[model samples]
Target: MGRTNLYIHYDAVTNHVMTRAINFEIQDFPKHYFPQNIILAESTLDFGRFDPQTNFKLIRGASEIQVYFESAHKEKMRISNWIDFETLEDMHGLTAQEIAEILYLFHANKALKSAFFYKLQNNYVYLTLPNGLNKVYYRHVQHFYPRFQRAMVVHMSELLNESRSLFFMRKAKVQALPLEIAEQVAPIFVNGLKVNFQQAYVKGSRHFVPLDIVEDELTLLTLDQAPKNHIGFIIYDSNAEKWSLELTLDRD
Candidate 1:
C-alpha cells in the first residue's frame, strides 16, 4: 500500500475547487497515474451546491484537468481543474483585482502600447511615427533546420534621404548560422545586394539595401560596425525619449 496527501482550494465565486496531491508507490507502478476509482468517486460530488439561483447545469464532472509530477523523491504531484459554471459573472468579480493590476501595468509600460495594434492584423503589427512607418512581419525560414523570424525597427528620415544612393547595395549579416560553426565564424556578405524593407516606408523608395550593406556603409563612415544592430539606427525624437518598436508576432 502507498500513502497519499491532497490539498484543495475552494473558490466560492467560481463555484469550483482546485486540488494538489502527493503520493508514494512502488517503482513498478506507473508514477503519477490517477486511478479510475478516484476520478469516479470525485464525479459523484454535488457540484451544484457550490452555486444557486442560476440555471447552469454541471453536465460533466471535471472534464478539463491537468496533473503533473512535481518531485520524484518526495513523490509530489500538482493538479488543476476548470469547472463550468452557469455564468462567469461571479468568477469575474472574484478575479477583478488581479485583472485590474494587469491593466494598470500595461498602461504604465510603453512596450504594451503596440499590444493593441498587433491584434489588428493576423500576423503583422504597424507603428506610425511622424516621418515613417515601421511594419513587422512574422516569417519562418529554413537553413539546416526550421526556425522562426520576427523583426522590429526605428525608421529615420535621415536614412531615407539617401535611400536612392544605397538601394542597390548588397550586404549580408549573420542572422543564424550552422549550429556547429555559428560560435566560431559569423555570417558575412558582399556589397551591392537589392533587398526589400519588410516595414512599409511611404516617403522613401520602396526598396532598401540589406541591413548588412547599411552596416558596412556606416562602418566606412564611422570606421567600424557598431558591434550590434541597435546602435546603427539612432535618431533624435521629441514626442518620446526613444522610438517605439512594434511587435511583429504574438507567440503561440
Candidate 2:
C-alpha cells in the first residue's frame, strides 16, 4: 500500500488494450530504506465497451490477475503468471478513447497523477495530465549548514505543480549556547556545500526524491499534504536539514 504506478495503452485501430500496474511495499529499514518489491499486473481488454467512469469493476477485477516478484528479473519465478495478450483480447471486448478519458478518470480517482499514450498507428501521442516529477527536478535546492538536533518541520505541498518550483534563502537567526559548547561546534558556517536535488519520481499521486543527503539537507521527496488535481509543492523535497526541522507531511 506504499507506492504504485499504473500504465495503460489502448490502440483504436488495432483494438488492443494493455494495462500494467506496479505495486511496492516498504522494505526493512537500514538494509533497504525504500519500497523495493515490484508487483506487476497486466491485462488486455476489448476496449470498445469499457466505460471510463462506471467500469471500476473492470479495473478492479484485473487486480486479481496479478503476479508478485522480489526483483525485476523476468526469469524470476512469479507467484502467479500473467495471461497472454492474445487470450486476453479474445476474452474481453473493450474500446478505449483515443484521448484517453480513462486516464483523466485515473487522475480524478487518484489512481495516478499523469500518464502518456503513444499510439502505434500514427505515432500520435496524448497525455491527460502533466508531470510533477519533471517539475521537481529543476527546482533550486540550496545547500545549508546547521548544528545537531535542529530538524525543522517544514511545509511545501501548497506550492508544487506542473511548472517550475524554486527556493532561495531568507534571513533567519538561532540562539547560541555557552562559549565552551560553541567551540566544540563550528560557530560560523560557510556557504558552497555544492548541493542540488536529484531526479524525482511519481508514486501514485505523490512525488518523491530518490537519493542520499550530505550533512543536513531534506532527504525524503514527499508532499506535506494531498492537493486538489494533484496540485501542491513544486518540489517534494525540503531544503531544511533533518536536525533543523521535523518533516511534517499533511497526509490529507
Candidate 3:
C-alpha cells in the first residue's frame, strides 16, 4: 500500500461502526476472530459505483452463507457528503446528524498523528469470531484491491539525491512532449536507466515528467523483478494538484 488510510466497519450485533487508524495485515485478523481461511471478497464495483442490492457469500468450513444489503431507499451515498436520514436508517441506526458527526470523527481520527483516511466502499463483510478462538469478537473485511488510477500530486519544486551517491531515475513519462517543447520539460528523468535526459519521446503519459528547471538531483530506480534494488513511480494527474505519500511494509 502506498499511503495507508483508516478503514471503517459496521458491527450488526452491536449496531456500531468501528474504524482502524492504520493498515491491518492478514495476521491481525485472528485476534479479531477472522479465520485463516477467511478470504476477503472484493466488491464487483471495486473502484466504481456501488449497487446496494449486491449479493455476497461467505464460506465457513463446509457451509456457505449469503449476505445482502438492504436498499437505502435513496439515490446514492458518497464519502464526506451529507447523508440523508433514509440512507442512515437503512445502513445503521444513526440519524443524519449523528452520521455526519461520525464522518467528522473519521477525519479527526485520521488527523491524529500523520494518519490518513483511506477510501471507503459501500460493501464491507463482517465476520464474527468463533467461541474460544481469540480475544476480539469480530472484524470487517476491507478490500485488498490495488488502486490503478491514482492521482499523483507533488508540491516540492526540487528533487533531492543521496548525500554522496549517484542518483538514478527510471519509469518517466511526459504528456505531450515535442522536439521543440521537449527542451522545456526535458530536465526530468526518463523511463530507462540514464544519468541525464538526452532525448525523450511520448509513448504514454506515465513515462513523462516536467522538470523544466533542474533544481534538485533525484535518482530514479528501475522497477525490475527479483528485488533489483530500484524504486519506480509513474506520474499521473487528476488535476487536483495534491499528492499523498503512503508507506506499506510487510509484517510478521
Candidate 4:
C-alpha cells in the first residue's frame, strides 16, 4: 500500500452516499463501475462536470447498482488546498460542509498539539505532524459528486516512511540494527521483515531471503532433496552437501 486515500461507499438500493477520513487501500474499480463513470461524464453537458471519483455502490444486490451523478450544489465549493487531505461529503442527508469546516479549523488552528495545520504556501495549506511525516492534498478538478466542499489530498514523498513508522510502530517491538545499515535499508527490514540472515551462505552476490517461516515442527532434508519452497529443511555446507530437517505434524 503505497499511499492511502479516503474512500466513499454508496448503497444503490436507496442511493445513499457516505465517506470516512481513513487511509483507504487503492484497488481497481469493478469492471461495471468504469462505464457508469463514463456515462456520468457524457450525460452532464453544461456547467460543472461529474466527478468520476468520490463514490461508488459497494453492494451488488443480485443486480447492477446504478451510479449517481448530480450537482451537489448549484454553486461550486472550494476550500484552501490542503497538505493532508480527502473530501468529505453531504449526500441526501450527510453533512459534508460542516465536517470539512470543523476539520479545516481544527488543523488550521493547531487545536491538537500532536497533529494540526501548520502553514500556507500561496494557494495551499500545510499540516504538520510529529517526526518528518507529511503528505500533500489537492482539490481535484472542478467536478463534484453528490455534495462536497472540496477533495482532500496528500503529497507523495519520501516522507511515507515517516508515516509507516509513526503509524505502525506504536507499542512496537524494538530491535537494535547495525549503525551503518540504519538509514540505508532499515525500513526494508521493517516492511514484512524480509531480511536474509543467511545471506553470507548464498554463493556470489545472491542474497536469498526466506519468504516466511511457518511456526511448525522442523523437518530434516538435504539440499538436493529440498522442495521448491521449504522451511526448516536443515542445511549447512553446500560444498559437502550436508543438510537435514525434522517435521512432526500431529492430526487427531
Q: Which candidate is the best by TM-score?
A: 3
Residues 1-252 of candidate 3: C-alpha lDDT, one tens digit per residue: 122222223333432233322222332322333231222223323222333332221222211111112111132322111111113124344345543443443433221221111222122223222221111112232221110011111111111111223455542222321223222212221222121111211233222222121122112211112222213222333233222221112211
lDDT of the candidates, in the order given = 0.23, 0.23, 0.23, 0.24
Best by lDDT: 4
Identify the runs in model 1 with alpha carbons over 4 angstroms from their true place.
1-94, 110-252
| Local accuracy of candidate 1 as per-residue lDDT tens digits, 83-148 | 222224433343444334323323332122222211111111112212111111111101101111
Instruction: Give me the runs in candidate 4 sitting further than 4 Å from their true place.
Output: 1-90, 101-205, 208-252
Candidate 4, 171-205: lDDT as tens digits: 32222222332233222211212111222134442
Prediction 1 global C-alpha lDDT = 0.23
Q: Which residue pairs overlap in candidate 1's backbone?
A: 169-192, 169-193, 170-191, 170-192, 170-193
Task: Look at candidate 3 and tell me the lDDT of residue 147.
Answer: 9
Judge candidate 4 at residue 36 and give its lDDT: 17
C-alpha RMSD for every candidate: 23.7, 20.2, 19.6, 20.7
In model 4, state the lDDT of residue 92: 20
Measured with C-alpha atoms, the lDDT of residue 146 in candidate 1 is: 15
> TM-scores of all models?
0.17, 0.17, 0.19, 0.17
